[model samples]
Structure formats: structure tokens, C-alpha cells
Target: MSQAKKIMNDPENLVDETLDGLVAISNGLLAREPGSRVVRSTKIEQGKVGLLVGGGSGHEPMYGAFVGPGLANASVSGDIFAAPAPQHVQEAIEAADAGAGVLIVYGNYAGDVMNFDMGAETAEEDSDIESKTVLVRDDVATDDYEGRRGIGGAFYVVKAAGAACAKGMSLEEAAEVTERVQYNTRTIGVAVRAGILPDTGKRTFELGDDEMEIGLGMHGEVGVERSKMMTADEVAKKMVDMVADDLPYESGDRVAVYINNLGATTQMELLIVYRKVAELLAERGLKVERTDIGAHFTSQDMAGFSLTLLKLTDEIAELIDAPCESVPFTQG
Candidate 1:
């Protein structure tokens, strides 16, 4: 097979250049930290909790794009699919500090955990900037909830945390809100085709033309099962069943449904999936308080989608509905 196509100046300069482009188009909302890969919001308010989220680069409009009002105050990015260096994370922690302390949020990956933890320690020791962390572990495919890998459900975590911080909640209160959101969220994804790693320019994994991998990780990690491609309705049923069952959602329970495009999946397909999800939820007498559909979290051109369900309480629902603005997620 022929190699995948990527457009860029140089593979080495990809992340930096992308940041430059994002800042340029941000209308002064985003600024890059000198000598580091960290991006910060230009409008962070003093005495409000600062939110910092970082991770590998390939997931566009995620860690970085999420830096704005009612979301992360800053974001640190590593090379594609790689964790940022500890020093980089520390720099973000320091920059995000605004006298109210900073909260570091990211996927529950081992490398991210280690690096961010070190960054928090550095900030506390050197800058006296108190830092806390909220690790998102919402993927239900894993048996270990505490150690479960974070997925698209990170959106809810960031949303709730950002809203709390914007409302002038204390750093501790914001962190608690974030943890609450994480606990109530769950996500599962299926991959119809694998994505190509930017540096290597090769597919992360191979999938048959007529097959799909269910419960696949964003980085193409092995999932629970791989089988023939099912109809959209069938796939939606399976995905919703797995996610809803895990949460043990019952009749009359309210939720926020997020249908995320893995990468190459089109909006049309996502809507089709959402339709099925909505139908299934309705069948179960579950109420969808809000719905977000788009490529909020992606795997770099991978053709698939993920279903994220946030079982909502009154407070959680209010947070998700709070006004926010970012490149990918925006609410009035």
C-alpha cells in the first residue's frame, strides 16, 4: 500500500509551527511561552484558579485548543503521541499560577502522570505555586477504574473544572468538581481504520477493510474485541449499551451525550451515530440534557468515533451548560 499523506514544512517543526499558526489566528487570545512548547490564555484573571492541561500533540483542539475561557488557562504539548518533558509541564504550572493555585488535568497515562507530578513538585518547591491534579479515568474498558485510561470524557472534566474556576471557586473546590465529573463520565470507541503516526508516517495498526476494532484506544491500543464492520445502527447499539450499562444508567436518569469523531469520520456519520444513540437512550427512558457532536477528541485522521456519556446531577448539568469558548468547544 502507498504511504499516508501529510502536509507540513518539516516533521521536526510540526508542533511548533502548528502552535504559531494557532496563536496567529487566536486574535490575541493565545500566547506562546518563550522558549517552551506551552501555550497560555492572555485573559487569565488573578485570584481565580488556573487550569493547565497537557498531553501528546496529535489530538488536535484538545489540550492546546482547549486553552481559553471556561476551560484550561494554559496547555503544554509534547511531540506526537508522546508525553511532554517534566520541565515543560513545570513551566506551564508556573505560568498558569495566578495566586489562586493551579490545577493540572490530563489523561491518565503513565508518562503524563509521572511528568505532571514532577512538574507539580517543581512548581511547589521552586515557585511556591500550589498545584493540584485531576486525572481523568473514564474509559470503562479497563478493569481498574483508578488506573483506567482517559479518553474523550476529558471534555466534561475540563468543562466542569473550568466553569468552577471561572465562577471564582477555590482551587480545592475546582479540583473536587473536576474529580466529580470524572467519576460520572465514561467513554468507549471503535476504530474502522488506523491512523498514521506523524513522525513515522505509517499506520499505527492494521485493520481489515471489512472489520472494526471496538473499545480501541485513541493511540490504537488493543481493545476488547475486533470484528466485522456492523451497520451504523448495530454499532451504535453496541457502543451505547456498553457505555450506559457501565454507568448502570436507569430510567429517568439524565445525561450529556458527546459523540466525538476519532479523526477521519465525517460529521454526517457522527450525526448518524448520534441519532442511534439518542434513539437508544430514549428507549431506555433516559433523558439527554445536552448533546455535543463533533471531532472534540481525535486520533489524527483515524476513521472512527467514540461515545461519551456523562451521567448528570443538577450541579454537573449546570456546569456543562455554562458558557465557554474554545476552538473546538464553545457554549453561550
Candidate 2:
């Protein structure tokens, strides 16, 4: 019943306006399609396979901020927490497609799957541009692998997909690698505070002043467990336990650890949690191959974070180590 506190002019035009500002900030590396919500990067790598990713907006620096030379070629944005239309998806695919075709990487939600599939069909029919799809399913808190939803772990999957394309892999090859990369990844998140929905000015959910919800979805779906707030170390141990156990990562394994801020949580808090996460991984005898920490994917101002682990193979390690540049994510 509480209205959300936020900054803005009109919720109706928030998504488009946000894209406009994004393109402006992109320094001409990105642009919006005429009369649509599709945004594509200007720095396309010719003769290389294209990587495209999209979904609902509101998770800033996600599907949109990821467009650039080394990440997604184009991004199709929908309203906050809403799926994009198939028409717009087709537009993005056409724009992103070069001589080598586009690989569409998105989350495993039902609306996204249906719309992205329809878009792929239209793109092939209209321009003969080939496209393939890879669904990211890394949220271990969900019912099962098949029923799981992609959460913060999507960042790593996008990184792998983009790196695959940058390495000149064929569309099919990139898709295959992306699928495997996703398969090796697992994630779990906890929320201490809910995000405020821009459209209705309503908070995503409610929590007690001193309580936490474990395993909540990116969109504020109820978590599997809720309890009184605990210390950062306690939260980290529980989250890492869920993620590490879901993949059932074995001792002596090398892994990439990503700490994603759900928004509103401070960097200081994140680092504190990371220290514990690193300790936990070490206790399990897993060698931390690489560490990424920041607010890559966020839900407005939700005060929480998620931990993701990618079990590394020789091939996946190479992809993860490969350098890439984008608005929100850039690394070597």
C-alpha cells in the first residue's frame, strides 16, 4: 500500500526517455531505431558473429548498457519489468546482423522466449539474416534447472557470449559456447529492501524493518526463505552455499566469482560480503580464478546483492579472460 519514492517526470515515457539519455551518454557508440525501442551499437565488428541480448527494462546497464563493440550488437528494451514486442526484437536483430549472423542471448522467462523466437523468425524472413537463441538459466533458488529463472548470473553469460563473438566464432559455435557457459554458472540472491516500481510508485514487496528474504527473484518474486537480518558473513555463507551446492562444484575446481549489487547496497557492504564469499570458497578448496564485483545488474533501488559462480573449464576460462568493453561492463 506504500507508494514508491523516486525521481522522474512521467512513468509513461520513462523507458524511452531513459534510452535517449543512454544513447547520448554512449558518445555515438549507440543509437535508437527510428520509431521503436531498439538500440544498436554503431561500432559493429564486420565479418564477426553478432551478439544480441534484450529483455524488460528497469534493470539498467543490463540489456541496453551492454551494447558496444565487445558485447551485444543491439538491445531491444521493453517497459520496466515488461517484455519487448516481437517487432522490436526483429528490428534489433536486423540492425545487429552482419555477414556472420546474430546470436540472441536472453533470460529464460516465458514472455522473453516467445517474443524473441518470433523476432528471430521475422528477421530471417525479411532480411535472410540467420539467428540463434541461448537462454540463461542460473538462478539456483528456483524449482529446478528447467524451471529456474535467470538472475544476476546473466552478466557472466553475456560476457561469455560477447567474448565468443569477438573471437570470431560462428553463430552456431558462439551459441554452443554460450549454452555451456550458462550451464556452468549458478546464482542465489537475498533482499533486505525491495525496489520501488517507477510506473505505479509502488514498492516491489514488503519486508520487516529487521528481516531479510533469501532467494528472491530479480523482479521481486518471493524468496524461498525469510528470516531476521544477520551479519554480512552469515548472508554470504548462506548465498554462497546455495550457489556452490546447486552446481555441486567440487573441491580443487577453479571458478569465477561475481558479486552483483541489487541496487542501493553500498560498495563498502559489497566488499565486506565478498571477503566472506572468498573465504567460503577457499574453505571449500575451490580456487578463485577471477573476481568481478559491482552493480552490473540492478532492480531500481533494491537493497540486496547476489553471488554467482562459474565453474571454469580451459575453454571457459579463456572466454572469461578475454577483454571486452561496454558501458556497464568492461574488462580484460
Measured by TM-score, the strongest candidate is 1
Q: In candidate 2, which residue pairs get closer than 3 Å at backbone N, Cα or C atoms, i.e. clash?
A: 4-201
| Model 1 residue 68 distance off true place after TM-score fit, in angstroms | 1.3
Residues 1-332 of candidate 2 have per-residue lDDT tens digits of 55467789888889988999888888888888555788888889899999889999999988778988768888889889878899999998988887899999888899999999999998899989999999988999986798788888899899889999989999989999999999999999999999989898788999999999999988999899999999999999888888888879999999999999999999999999999999999999999989999888899899999999999999999988888877777776
Off by over 4 Å in 2: 1-3
TM-score of each prediction: 0.98, 0.97
Model 1 pairs whose backbones collide: none
**Candidate 2 Cα deviation (angstroms), residue 221:** 0.8
Worst 10 residues of 2 by lDDT: 1-10
> For model 2, what is the error of residue 281's alpha carbon versus the real structure, in angstroms, after optimal superposition?
0.5
In model 2, what lDDT does residue 16 have?
Answer: 87
Candidate with top lDDT is: 2
The number of clashing residue pairs in each candidate reads 0, 1
